[model samples]
Target: MAVIITNRSLADGIYMMEVAWEGVVSPGQFFMVRAWETDPLLSRPISVHDYQDGVVTFLYQVVGKGTAILSGMEPKNTIQLEGPYGNGFPAVDTPLVAVGGGIGIAPLYYACRKFKEDNPKKKLRVYLGFSNEAYRVEAFDAIADEVVVDVGGIIVGQVDVKRGETFITCGPRVMMDALCQVVPEKNPVYVSLEARMACGMGACLGCSIKTAEGNKKVCKDGPVFPREVLEG
Candidate 1:
């Protein structure tokens, strides 16, 4: 369902938090948002970074047309959102390691906030990697234990992957794959995928990901999924 909320900008192009919603919004759930009515495209899917009180927050880079519009809104301004969709990151009672890169950092932020609430006793570690220190998400510092950013901090190439017993992520395929390789096949590992999506639902059948269980939708079935499921 669509909920109207007042939005605020924390930074000119990076941070923005929203407050105003009537119901529960869980970790890893996304909001379908449309900031400009004149624009031809429909609402864009943005993952919830964290929500407290009646406020919901999102941290995104100005990477596209839709997000650029969203990044421009002022405080007390209202925006439309349809939301809290898709399966969330599975609850892990044990220690969890969250890894992220670039725009993919939002999902892990949501997870860390939830962990602090639900599993206060468990050790929750968070790691973030960006192309360089400049592009890194500093917001992760509050949520993560040991944050890393460097060309060679965790894994290399176009991906940011790290494996600890209990781990989850949202980033490029190459980064997720590197983390998957280190985490034992038997151990539980969750990865939030960023696959191309024409429609953020299963109807388009556009975000199918090759899996052991067969192709899966990155939007409907995921955006969050088990790492083992991706291993061939």
Candidate 2:
């Protein structure tokens, strides 16, 4: 169990929660979070928004019963967390381009930070899209060479895919599909997918997604995958 350091609204329905944790967490990985014991039954899988010092942050949208419960909790409240699970985005030498839509921006923040840390000389560009109000768009300024934000329109259209660039994206399925269509054959694009999960481990088989290599569990094999494998 982790204690809530802070849980506050960033915007309407969007909340950022910081929990006390000292675990090793990778970008694109998530934790199965639950603030209640008996009522909700299962935990919600929330992606790592950022991790620093001894605290891990989660940027989550209050969409349903579970998240609503989470949003109501105050500081010092104890919540259950089960993981830093699944395969994370890969570190690459190529110029990095990150695309996020709405709540999808959660994981990419950490991924971009880690990328810049490892490849200091390489360039990183970020694009964020929101249907309404945008939050934390300013935070990317520190990690990105350039940051572009779009509202109420196609955010993917803003990205200029180039040769030898590595792209990482998470968002609405339609937006992700649009991105896949434009990326050149040589440039590699990786996507993070969301799915409802039960155990958060491979044992439940609740988050299986069909891929080129049969079905893969999102909670186990990935919440991240190369565009090619998903396309296959």
Top TM-score model? 2
Error of 2 at 150 (Å): 0.4
lDDT of 1 by residue, 77-171 (tens): 67777767778888778777777766677777878878867887776666666654434356566655556664435543333333435777777
Clashes of each: 1, 0
Return the clash pairs for model 2, or none: none
Residues 98-183, model 2: lDDT tens digits: 99999999999999999999999999999999999999988898889999999998999899987899999999988988999988
lDDT of 1 at 141: 65
Can you tell me which runs of candidate 2 are displaced by over 4 Å? none
Following a full C-alpha superposition, what root-mean-square deviation does model 2 have from the true structure?
0.9
lDDT of each: 0.70, 0.93
TM-score of 1: 0.83
